[model samples]
Target: MRIYFLSRRKLILLLMFLITIGGLLTINLLTQTIPSLVRTPGTYYMAKTQEKVVALTFDDGPDPVDTPDILNILKEKDVRATFFVLGKAAESNPALLKRLVKEGHEIGNHGFTHDYQQRKLVAEMNQTDQVVFNSTGNHTYFYRPPGGLVSKTQMEATKRNGHVVALWSVDSKDWRNPGVKQIIDNVMKNVFPGAIILMHDGGYQRTQTVKSLEPILNALKASGYRFVTLSELRTLDSDLK
Candidate 1:
């Protein structure tokens, strides 16, 4: 009798396992039919299509004072870059948003309020995207966390909205009020093929960033590096697809 009971338990457990697997497969198939209303799972900000090209991602932007200067340098250099503009600032300064679009720069959401206390606030993400996307749809489905703060939950939220979560490998510390030369040094030291460089255009004390942009861009350009926007750069490989 004891042996028979154990055999029954094993068969029951196997049956339950098969049921769960079948349910998961059904759910996954249903999701594909529902269309992608969420983000894909990947942390890419540069194209893997080449070896020497680097993508530049500037966050916290639409600053009426400093951003224009950065745009000018980009135009003069004839290079394309990505700007993750905060939704609140973009809403307030429509002209700045227009400039970015008109100048062929890719704009992405950086949260509406620029608060970084939470890893990934779904409420904040929804609110920011509603304001930025429904209003203009100028932004691509690309976003960065406020201050690089991220968690598994937050990252999942980023995907649900059909956006990619961009994290930087090279930070210039421009947010900490570093001088131009030091910021330049930081980029030069950390740069490599397929590197994503982080700088700010709209956050507090971004003037120092403006000063650093010209020299850094010139140096990188001189070094056989080509600048591409984060979206363009994200085609790193077919693996992401």
Candidate 2:
């Protein structure tokens, strides 16, 4: 029989090295898996299309202050985007919701309140859907959760409520008040064919987002990209057909 023994100091050093390697591996696995795990199934991040089509989606909106400015900019630029509005906000601003529909913009469900219990998420979604339908006579088939945090169970509930999860490929991070230049830069950096850009029209002062809007549109237009609503962007996807 052959026996090998390490000194106590060497054993401690080896144990520390092993612990460091295990920790790194654990972090790497989590980084790779958590994003995929959090994303709901049947979610549309970007379309699979050859056309230079992009969808600009705003969340937590229909604000009397910022939403009007956003709609005005879209109207002026002759561009149409999707607004995912909360039910409470939609109820308070039916005219804005009506204007969104009347102006040829798309409306989506962003839940009743910003947050809800997991079991009640579907009810919240349905409530928003009802509000949208009542306000605009248009049923909202798309939904985005607050803070983009969704679980499998919540997604299943959303599916039961007949809503497709709408995630984003190009996140502007504009909700953080990241400044107009950074917002534009974030969108420009991730802009691509069939990209869905995330911005916000409600939930805090969206002055920076409002300011960043036109320049982003102009730059993308210069790059030969055409803007489309989320539904239209879905139609561009051959996979969906």
lDDT of 1 by residue, 33-108 (tens): 3211222245554445556878887888788889889999999999888888787877777787777877888887
Candidate 2: worst-modelled 10 consecutive residues by lDDT: 31-40
lDDT of 2 by residue, 155-178 (tens): 777788788888888888787676
Q: Best-fitting candidate, measured by TM-score? A: 2
lDDT on C-alpha atoms for all candidate structures: 0.76, 0.87
Collision pairs in model 1: 38-159, 38-160, 38-162, 39-159, 39-160, 39-162, 46-233, 47-233, 48-236
Model 1 Cα shift for residue 57 (angstroms): 1.2
Candidate 2's TM-score = 0.83
Candidate 2 CA-lDDT value: 0.87
Clashes of each: 9, 0
- Backbone clashes in candidate 1 total 9
